[model samples]
Target chain A: MSTVKQAGGRPRESRVDHALAEAVRALLSEHGYASLTVDAVAARAGVSKAAIYRRYATKEEMTFAVLVHDLREEPPADTGSLRGDLTALAARIGDQIGRSAADVMTGLLADVRADAALGARFAATYLAVERSVIATLLDRAVTRGELPERPDSPVVHALLLGPLFTWPIVLGEDPDRIPKLAPVVARIVADALIAGALPPAAQDGLSGGS
Target chain B: MSTVKQAGGRPRESRVDHALAEAVRALLSEHGYASLTVDAVAARAGVSKAAIYRRYATKEEMTFAVLVHDLREEPPADTGSLRGDLTALAARIGDQIGRSAADVMTGLLADVRADAALGARFAATYLAVERSVIATLLDRAVTRGELPERPDSPVVHALLLGPLFTWPIVLGEDPDRIPKLAPVVARIVADALIAGALPPAAQDGLSGGS
Candidate 1:
């Protein structure tokens, strides 16, 4: 008896994945997070729902895939100086925010709130990638003796992203403000790095000394 | 025919308002942002939907009211020194996180992501209150000469909350880790304030001399 061999290799079309990702990105930009739907993505991509499902198990997974694909893998070029490296990194981040990334972020945040599991997954995948990139940059600075060899690198990383996230999203500042703020932030980071690297006793006297 | 006016100037019921606010907090804790609903809030509050509508007009308003009611009105008590004041503030924030405040924050962030207008409202009501409180503490530090006046006061305020918001929520670290990190963060703020307050040439040489 000849058994029908089920074709288990290379089962899906790569085009479908690309289309779905694009569709999800478009929908995220247009509708923000609250109104995004799997059905809408499938329709926008002009692909069968079955095809989309074969790739992604849920809307959350699909949305996450798009973000993963979009997030840059490495920090911008080093430029041999901390200020230049940070300036480039800040500018790239600012560009992303101007591209309606705020809408995508809002959607992802909403998903995390709705489902605890999704929140964990989102953090593990998207946030971890961005943070690791920043950490690597700071590590480079430490190796070059540009920053102190303290345990506060993580705190500095948070300071960089926190204002970027909070000002527009929470404080309702115009996106145009980021360009001006980027240099100011770079200066603050420079000062903090310089001061943090100093010896404890000597550092204490500087602030209080006439 | 004589028309009679409602008792207590438009017949507002304090009991209904309190119930609605409590219901909102409960929903935030239990269901987070995506699952919370105005209908559910009314049901849980044991009040007519019309009664809730009369007070809030929308779920966003109800959520705002709950956050306003729950937010800490002032920074922790003065400890006579900047470090002591900061330690007390960090501990108070830690307490809030240990309670239901983290859940409320998760829900608020989710709501902001799903709805731009709702996010704006959340920022104005909830985050603004926190910022103002931190600003007050930093202002005290400046007065005590522990912090320099050169760095914008808002920047100093951001330095305090930036780590708290970025690490656990954005980076998804354990909330319990905040207090452990607070002292290092305080040091950075202190250093930044000192460096910024110095004259330009002195500021440039402060980090290099050490």
Candidate 2:
């Protein structure tokens, strides 16, 4: 939502920013990350290069902005049970990985390798934002006491996000496998939390009961 | 180890292949995947460009050869319990991902996006090789009765390898968190196996004694 303010105190045109983002996304999809260029984005968006420079410090920043714009807003509140909340969250995450989002992500990896500065920005902006969202959901589960606090939130977050991103790369399969992954990961994490709270002996054979 | 034989009766020069692989690895570590070229590799290896081409039809093949050469050999065979086998396997995997191996893997991703033919070859040679190795190890576990026969061997393979690759990209941390990851995953999978075999009521709680 941040916009540049001109010297005359007028807000920069939101329409231009929107167009630039669309152009960037289109280029990212069509030409891929390796071929996308700021100049091309400016030409396609019909915005002056100077306007883009005024809005984003660098091409990497522009790409980061596009990703941020495309990312789904945080999961909606009031799904009720932890299972429902997670199922909804997983579905959204899966969708992002399923379509153009995966291409964008793969392109980002290429961009990151090509430019170290871009990689750092991507880590800070795109990855950090996603991690924070997952962490927030995990925190909610702990507060609700549907799960115990023992597996460490970040570990659980990694467990969930790790498989989501990795499936396509390692398995060479569709990201829609979230329907399968969500339940398996959710069950494992739930079991770990519940097991961690129990005595060692009691934890040994614990199974399906939540 | 399969190599296309020369039809004219002269055996292929093993040295050329070795030199090309070494050159490819060096170039990957230095210039990364984007900058690597078959010509540069041939030059660096002091081998004729024709010699390199005769060995590898493309740069992708040379790169794949380098990766397979760099991958640690199939894990050592042992009669140890499932926990020991998994722990050792995790450590070995961690070592590979921890060292320059991970950089090579990421570089491969960039190359895959740059060339479709290369991507297909890379996936078949590298990804397929890694999956086969993991599958072999897991099969040993099944034979030992530590794992139940699941028709989903491929899914389990992905679940394991996915996290290994995902951690570096998603968390931007050491992929060797395997020490922590191994036991947790092993425990979960082991429980899933037990759950598959046991009666419904027995599945709910973790009792220490049999």
- Which residue segments of model 1 deviate by more than 4 Å? A1-22, A47-58, A61-72, A82-84, A101-103, A146-156, A186-210, B1-33, B38-72, B75-104, B112-124, B138-157, B197-210
- Give a tens-digit lDDT track for model 2, residues B1-210: 323323233335656656666787788878777778888997999988887776667765667555543223465476465556555665555555555444456665655646667666656655666666656766676687766652244455555555555666545655545455555665554455445522222232211112
- Predicted model with the maximum lDDT: 1
For every candidate in turn, the CA RMSD to the true structure comes to 9.9, 8.1
TM-score of each model, in listed order? 0.69, 0.74
Q: How much lDDT does candidate 1 score?
A: 0.60
lDDT of 2: 0.58
Cα lDDT computed for each candidate against the true fold:
0.60, 0.58
Tell the DockQ for candidate 1.
0.20
For candidate 1, the C-alpha RMSD (Å) to the true structure equals 9.9
Among the numbered candidates, top DockQ falls to 2
The segments of candidate 2 whose C-alpha lies over 4 angstroms from its true place after superposition are A1-14, A64-83, A101-103, A146-154, A176-180, A197-210, B1-21, B68-85, B101-103, B146-148, B175-210
Residue lDDT tens for model 1, B1-210 = 000111343324656666777787788777665577888998898988877676554565566555533333567787777667766765665445434454456555555555667766656655667667766776687788876543443444455556666666665666665665566556655655555533332233321232
